[model samples]
Target: MTSDRMTPEVLWSMGRIGTFNVSPDGNTAVYTVTYYSVEQNKSHSVIYVLNLNSKAQTLLTTSPKSEYSPVFIKNGQKIAYLTAESGTSQLWEMNVDGTDKRQISFEKDDISEFLFSPDEKLLILIKEVETDASIAKNDSDLPKASGMVINNLMYKHWDTYVKSIPHPFVARFNGDRIEDSTDILEGEPYECPMMPFGGIEQLSWSPDSKSIAYTCRKKTGKAYAISTDSDIFLYDIATKSVKNLCKQADWTEQPCDTTMSLEHQAVNHQQKDNNVGYDQNPAFSPDGQRIAWLSMERDGYESDRTRLCVYEFATGNKTYVTEKFESGVDQFLWMPNSKNLCFSGVWHGKTQIYTTNLKGDVKPLTDEVADFSLVSLAPNGKDIFCKKHSMKQADEVYLLKGNKLEQITFENKHIYDRLTMGNVEERWVATTDGKKELCWVIYPPHFDATKKYPALLFCEGGPQSPVSQFWSYRWNFQIMAANDYIIIAPNRRGLPGFGMEWLEQISGDYSGQCMQDYLSAIDDLKKEPYVDEEHLGAVGASFGGYSVYWLAGNHDKRFKAFIAHDGIYNTQQQYVETEEMWFPNWDLKSAPWIKNAEGQMQKAFRESPHLYVDKWDTPILCIHGQRDFRIEYTQAESAFSAARLRGIPAQLLLFPDENHWVLKPQNGILWQRTFFRWLDRWLKPDNK
Candidate 1:
């Protein structure tokens, strides 16, 4: 029987594919697939290999322990991956045909990530080393401490404490057994790949395999508290020496000049103290003549535009390759020919792949409305392998052969064939200031123009990030539409894509034009004959959650209910409490209590959600995770308490183990169920 509607279970059952690497010959590709079991309430990943010629796929690894980051080595005849089969995650290798499996690295600590050298004789690995003074590297070495003695600002990160710092190590494979291991980043007070959300992309190997380029912040102790100045460093294997590739001249100790503006002086002083600005995702050219990486201008601003830069090895000069490109360059890879580079960035509400030459001439390689993440480029430089996804389909591996694109994997086909997905369309609504804002509207499944449906306006979290036409595992719109609710996601001002000016408009004044833009979109959405304006509701997470709170207080009568997940309750508190101080500092223009021109407090503090609690009368569902350090759990507690104190219907969903996002398989289902039930309670009373 054909499936009638898509449910949370079906979405969870489908395999989630990630990170593939093509063989040197480009004839085979190895990728990882993760599947979750609801009964076990856990997920495990396995590696698979696909033949590009015959489109035949074979399972390579079937270990109960999860295996990930599969890459071809030994002249494309062997594969290597990371697994915890021996307790801690260690490097494992096997033949191309899945035979002769053997463990490679036997380090006491688990290897976080590893990459093969171009010659395949050596491996570059990143592992965690205990940095906390009280914690012993080996548990048996010393008695266990009951409590952690904190000495630094970054003692605790997003979801875990700073027990260890990530360091890079080099190991040589002597054909029989791996030997000659060395820690390259031992003395430096730097974390390669930088915390929170960094992976193998932060490290790059030169074509000759003699030098490795990696990104790291040199700041230590109290200096790391307010600065995010990271730079690319080149490490030589033979000499064991490191040199900063993007270091700037000393400027921190300069006397205050009366001619310079205060803002300019402050920025220069910060950079002088921090040295190099934020640089990440280093990619070495095929010939090893130059290196390309992403660089940000300001020192303490994490939201600054990421411009692409190239550093020449011979001249020791750096040049900006994407100065004219308005959008930030997120990821890029050097072409096999070493003359061109392929990158993925947000453009007009969608992430597309583009190619740029050394001289800065850029051309769009893929212009589809869907989002595309570049996986690997063919060795011949003729085919591009990418993972593409849209609102109607989950992410699947696709091969771009010349102008023709062919889907190579059917991992999600079983789920896709049975899903009755809604019709998705992009609409532009006029804002109050005569500006047009983009919004994506997903009509309910089996939608009828003559029938009215309750609308759910989804507030995208980034405030700076866009709600692109991409598939989301957590906030899947198809499942919502299957439940007969119209989904509307608006790309308000401050969201990426429509240009930097539009993105910066909502910085200091988050509740100003951006809020009006959301309101305008809702008003325009209400004009549709199929929209049920009386039962409309709003939902958001992070910045989006902040928007929902703002709406509850100011536009309470319009939205029947509001759902804020891990939102900010008080802006002033968020500035100090958040782990990354650069975000709030850049957005608010200064620290809290700093006055603007009129001698008033910063706009961010003045427009905090906590101050307008008296006006919040609408029912609200607040969700928070205890481990969410980005936006503390107290934000949700305060919001839920305020609503209850005001005698308004309120509910709180707390996840003790989860972080900012509800990532666990069972918790994800519970979150979805709770979300739908809350909407049903207020928006669709008859259905309840």
Candidate 2:
């Protein structure tokens, strides 16, 4: 291996730029840059303002507390960002040249997210408040509860217990200080912006700044267990009134009754089995006369197609603008004219920008290749800026002009100039069932066609998510290629961007057709003379991890080694322990205890990787995080136990502070080192 190649240290040292906000004049842009310190094992972010006219950038905030979410306010003279310099994340104001920094909010609770009103006189902030304030009251004489009391279905979320829920608050900002604050959803049990990954996108202010629209769940209790019903609510700031825009007649506001009778037959059974939908990401048009948001058609199905919808303020009418659009919409914004919208969505394994009108007319603005996101449109809607990245390059700001993309930022140019990255090529392979799948291969740097190299097949997690041209921090193909290894990533049958039918094929059959597709991909790769057939390895995370586990038992002879990260070994137990019940319920088609044909206790059990553990013979490496509530830590324990019991060579890597993904700077370095070492032990023994 060469010392001048791209390594984990070099990758971590590169700055990560995100959240762009163009000034009103379009002469400048403000964005956040996050830099990590591997030695300190911490990250610090600061805001930077780039002068489009001079092509010069200036640091806007030098706060050590980590500033982010930079936005131009006060007619582009001053900038506002969030910082924890005051012990909690609060709104802070500073000059455009990184001067006159002042704290604006003095709240006891930490602000999750905030947005300035169009008029700049009010600040709408989202804060998480305890359900019972008394529980959080610090009584020095009183002892804290040793154990958590569970009483609700949502007692826990992704990685934490649900002790408090996020709510919105309206504050009157007088440029220097907050005059007063009012809780918008004070008495409601709903959480604005929903949970998990929701952010500022869920809240929107009207053009006049008189009303605000946000998304929240209307159903509680067991309804939440199998329901994905989230509705947009309009709150009038003047009258302090709220209305559920998506609520239907006869909708009861009462809490669910869970009491059962002695006979277990006379219990409260009035709960309706309704298949409502999810509506979120509300954005008001420039004219403020209409509101646009993304909506899902069916309830309880998270993978349902997302359609763009618009609501007219004057007519009180709603319309679906993307009903005919085949792909799901990820993020979008209204044009300045308020007649059209620009959005980014996945198409053929790539995310491209597109334009759509209220009449449902959709047109692609970019090609169906290379990953593009974090779109920012100028005030005139003529200039568009987005972050673009590919297999060979990291994300850099690019300006979309006409049909050509102009790179505006070269943050990683210095790092790229000194390193020799692999050559990436896209290929289409035919599966065993005669279906063509998209696969990407990366050849080692300074490669020769006559020489064979060890290959590592990387499976994506989503099972439904496509492994596009996006640059990944975790499963970096460049680093693998730098280690003198060929990397192969296949977009199999169950992945997205290939149409709805193909994506839903893996549902209720995780180990069936998808496994065959993977096997077919590997067989196709072996046909190439540059691939070493004798030293093949497989690696994946999440669903991909599940696939690796399944392959370890059912087809171990094909690969020399395997790596599974946060994978499900026991499908039956996964269904019962996962926090998100709807995913398992929909994927498996029923509860774990439900019986199927031949008196089998759960149809998904047939696809369980644990069932075929007796046939396992391959050496494997298992990686899991204790904070991964989605898959739970027990899955890793069970996998490692099975491998050790079978007397097969296996190793376990556990992260106590990390989540599903290895995010921290130091942890990421450790993860990469461990991963490459495991692969080297079996696949690259000669190098060792």
Candidate 3:
């Protein structure tokens, strides 16, 4: 085989090239380069600048420290990025030539998202301030007797939990000086509504640099903080006053119990549109006269109807464009001239980019794009800069001109090196929602076409996520394939590439339909020759964790075993007790789930696998970190107790200092080893 056929050392590398920012002249582009070493089973990132004019690339930073999200600032001579080294993440800005590297933020410790302003005058970074609410008077500091007998769900789902740690405000990227800056909107450790995390996301400075507009989440609650709704917020620099641009819905009066919504499934789903709240991605019109954004007429988790509202700042006049257009709009950009706008949204399940004028004249701009990212038209409106990920590759940046598509990066050129072409097959199946789901089938190291083998199904949990089709070191289709298991992974519904309906559909009913969808995907796999249904098992984390529980209860007889890393089993209780009040706040309708516990309990109880422990007999594995602030350890504890009460097979594993997503390297390897061991014991072809 030619060297070209062999994946390049540089090509077969890390995570992804993200945070693409074009230079002012559009000749130089800087993007993030990431890769995860499987042997190391760790993630590393760096910044690279690619020059279109010279066809040259410059890689920055020295070894040991990973830099990400590089962008040209201060007239394109310097770039600002977030760097993680020495166990701390802080702001750093350096010259284009990689000299004069200086640390900007002086936080003793932090993880932040930062950007240089359009004018390059100030640097803005989102800092997560960890406050120890250890409660000096807590029952004890010597670790309580947490030895709850393991249950089937914990063993089957591989469930885990962590103490609630503070989450930084969402979408709260402020325009502040990185060196010595005042926070625009920061999460107060003890705030009730955890709306800050995404409050300032999708932000763009007004052309005049006078103010900023962003989407903010505010939940009216007395219990920990939850965002009953998200709305548009306008912050004026001069007056330093933050104005709530929309009316606040009386969520309190109605009660926020997840179960008791009077609205029908469809009605509850469309709740984002009611006057109470509506909107995301607030972008200022190029001319600064108007702002265009997405607003849900109905604001439920799965509701699909959203409008493009053009707000005239001066006159306070609002005009709704694309009225009742339900296909979800994922991303939008102001056509350089601001006369026309280009946005990427879903239509019939596939993500397609559309261009429209202020009058609402819309046209399907691209026909062949199955998935799209970075949907901005070139300054001339002649082309759009986007990364199009096909079944063949994860994502690639493409320049869509008048009649042709130009590939901008060759990042994935040798992604499939060393793998036989015939062994890598792409499969498509229908998800629970009737949308077409895509999956990649990788045969074992020496796969025989006619042979059947045990298969492993891996699911990733996120509102708009896929099972990670791209190459990875720790876990990917290829990694699983090497482990002697046919990886029958599916990119199920509710992923961004599919569009808004599928993405939003799984919102409120996270454990509801999405869980069923996982079951459907496995059922579909059973029909394939290469898959062995009788020897099937599944693994997922976070949202995927919730699904494992949902599936374990509803479809335990289907799998030999299960693993749910950081899964939530008891939603009714989890809805209130979790640390980051915001998750429960946003997921649940209001707060004090106990208020409607009678009905909410019935809803969660009906859905919770823990409530129906009698149905679970499958071996399960549960994992959690005592320090996790996202979903508390009690969730898994509550789940484990129920599993054992019913005398189901279960095992519980606890990490004293880990969080939502395992970060400690030593523990990650341990978790993965234990998880796969449990899988091998149950799903191993030889074991049987």
Summed backbone clashes in each candidate are: 0, 0, 56
TM-score per candidate, in order? 0.95, 0.94, 0.74
Candidate 2 per-residue lDDT over residues 137-225, each given as its tens digit: 33556566455545556566788776778888999988788658778988876677688888888999988889999888865445665
Q: Residue by residue across 236-335, what tens digits does model 1's lDDT show?
A: 9889888888775543423432211223446544523233457898999988899999988766656667888888989888877776678888788788
Score residue 323 of candidate 2 by CA lDDT. 64
1-688 in candidate 3: lDDT tens per residue? 2322212232235246666777666787778767756457566777877876675878876656778867676667777788886678877778777888887666664655654445555544455443323222224554675543332111111122212322322222233334445556654333111223342245657777667676555532232232234567777766867775554344333445443332343434434434333477788887888888877654333244556777777877667666545455667778867778777765533466777787878887777625666535565656778877643355667788864788777665655554433255667777666656766666666677687877766767654455533444234454455556776666666665455556656544566666666767778878878677788877777666776676777775888877776777777667545544434434444443444535553344346556666677777777767765566777677667667777876777788877666654556566666766788888875765
Which structure is stronger by TM-score: 1 or 3?
Answer: 1
TM match of model 3 to true structure: 0.74
In model 1, residue pairs whose N, Cα or C atoms come closer than 3 Å (at least 3 residues apart or on different chains), thus clashing, are none
Q: If candidate 2 were superposed on the true structure by all CA atoms, what would the RMSD be?
A: 3.9
Off by over 4 Å in 1: 1-3, 133-144, 249-265, 268-276, 596-599
Question: What C-alpha lDDT, on a 0 to 100 scale, does residue 403 get in candidate 1?
Answer: 64
Candidate 1 has its poorest 10 consecutive residues by lDDT at: 253-262
